[model samples]
Target: MKASVKKGLGTTIWLLSMIIILGGALAFALNPSPAKSIFGYRMYEVLSGSMTPALRTGELALVQITPPQDIAVGDIVTYAVSPDGTTVVTHRVVDKTTDSEGQTVFSTKGDAADTVDTNVPAAAVIGVVRGHIPIIGYIIGFVRANFIASLMLIIAAILVVLAVKNLSAGKKKKPANPS
Candidate 1:
């Protein structure tokens, strides 16, 4: 590929990555829910080491909303404990049974915890773990906890990357000589 074309492609890729990163940051900030299932899966940030070895703090979990009946014992799931569905907890299902009202309920526990979480309603279950992305949760948490600072840092980094690319691209261009 030509130098200019290669440079353009690189710039495009960088911009696209920044867009995705910033968009995610914005979504996290605006949404009250921990994981909003966008496109079939919800992205959640692990805040504690409760599920360590399987999931850790600073990692991101991609969970897919599945029927409570479909969730079997030993599956990791994200669930809401709050009435408004804002507060969420991610843990492993140790047992499953129906409640007094004939409602499906689950007993969940953090892998690293000493005790089990009693009776999590199926309605509160948000999703089952589908995959994990390491280290992104830290970034999300940092951005959420320090919005302005993170935004400034992100903007500054983007500027630096673009500036460096532009400088390198300029250096590669040569002046035409008169015949």
Candidate 2:
């Protein structure tokens, strides 16, 4: 009978994976977006006139759509439209009325818009503008668009795959084949 034990790079990779997963989970819960240096969702450069004075064209807006329950009044939110349409509407909540069915409906309108928007179902909200870096979001967006982190991801994938293959191969081989 042959017995195999984890060793060398395999042990290192396993330890690294455990550390990373646990570390990421801890950081995600304790550390904020800034502390972790990770944005929860895609951000875009405002290219529309709707946001106007508040968020001029070319200004960066970090967008992340969450469930209706997360939507709050006065939150700058973006919503998606049906059929390949999307609106980067940044507006304050004017009013909220709950339906008899236990659903909360919020009305929001952009600062520059003429009237309150179509009743924004609490379901349609993205997220609050927690913080901003003025023009800095654009730089981050450009880097992501170009896949600047591609190399890091590729290396991580290779390491994981090699570790898995080596670990499995170690288990299958007979002791007589040791070399």
Candidate 3:
């Protein structure tokens, strides 16, 4: 490839990478709740082995908001475990039914669990799991727990890359001395 083409390609890649990193950092910083959704999707870090063999611990689960009436048995879902909606759990819906007041209730169980969990109300449902990425949850959890350190590390990495690039450019621009 020509030098100009190579340079342009490199610039484009660098710019794209910066946008991704900075955008992620900004999102993380501005997140108001643990269950906040982006573009109608929410991400949850699988924290236990309950859903193992399907959704493993350390994997990142992508969940999409779904109406209670739309949920069916056998669909994996993430729901609030506490009344305050502070704690969340992801499991497969083993049964679905309506309660005395005609409210939708779902009984969930882990893939590896021996028994099903208590019935969860439709109001507590966060979303249905759409997909997952292995090990990304661990990285995201670490960064979120250490936001300041992660941000500093990212900034430092960017600086080092820029410095190295400038140094190399400077060397390439130096005129060759005639022997």
Candidate 4:
């Protein structure tokens, strides 16, 4: 490839990668609580095999904020297990009905379990599981635990890319002809 073309391609790839990484980092940083969301979506790290076959442990679950009234049976939902919203659980809604107060209540169960769990009130429901990325939760956990090291690695990667681009550009240059 021509040197100019190579340079352009490299720059484009670098910029795209940086944008994705930085955007993810920013989203992760802004939402310190799993119950909180960024762009209407909350990210939670699956800690158990409760929803196995659909969602596995070590995966990152992407839950989108959905109205409790819109939630239907068979939908996977993440709900706050504690009043403070610090503890959360993801399970499949096996039943849905209106309580005496006219509020929606959901009965959830783990796919691998034989028994249904206690009914969860609408107020405790965080959102519905939209999607998940396998094994990304582990990587995110590591990055969070070693944030400084991860940042340094990202900076080093950028420097290496720049150095390689410069070296390639230099090799593409030709010496001036003898006078």
RMSD of 1: 4.0
Clashes of 2: 0
Model 4 Cα lDDT, one tens digit per residue, 1-179? 99789778978897788969886775674456755667999888888898888999889999999999889999999999987897899999999998899988999999988999999999999999999999988777777778888778877887897888788878778687899
Residues 96-126 of candidate 3 have per-residue lDDT tens digits of: 9999999999999999999999999999998
State every prediction's TM-score relative to the real structure: 0.82, 0.47, 0.80, 0.79
In terms of TM-score, how similar is model 1 to the real structure?
0.82
Instruction: Assess each prediction's global lDDT (C-alpha) against the native.
Output: 0.87, 0.60, 0.87, 0.87
Q: lDDT score of model 2?
A: 0.60
Segments in model 1 whose C-alpha atoms lie over 4 Å from true places = 1-21, 175-179
Compare candidates 1 and 4 on lDDT and give the better one: 1
Candidate 4 versus the native: TM-score? 0.79
Stretch of 10 with least lDDT, candidate 4: 26-35
How many backbone collisions does model 1 have? 0
Task: Please say which candidate is ahead in lDDT: 1 or 2.
Answer: 1
Off by over 4 Å in 4: 1-30, 174-179
Estimate, for each residue in 1-179, the C-alpha lDDT of model 2 and write its tens digit.
22334455556777688668745543443332321224555454565657667676556676554566776677777654443334445666777789788888888887788988888666665666554436654543444455436435546876787778778877776477568
Candidate 3 Cα outliers beyond 4 Å, as residue runs: 1-26, 29-35, 171-179
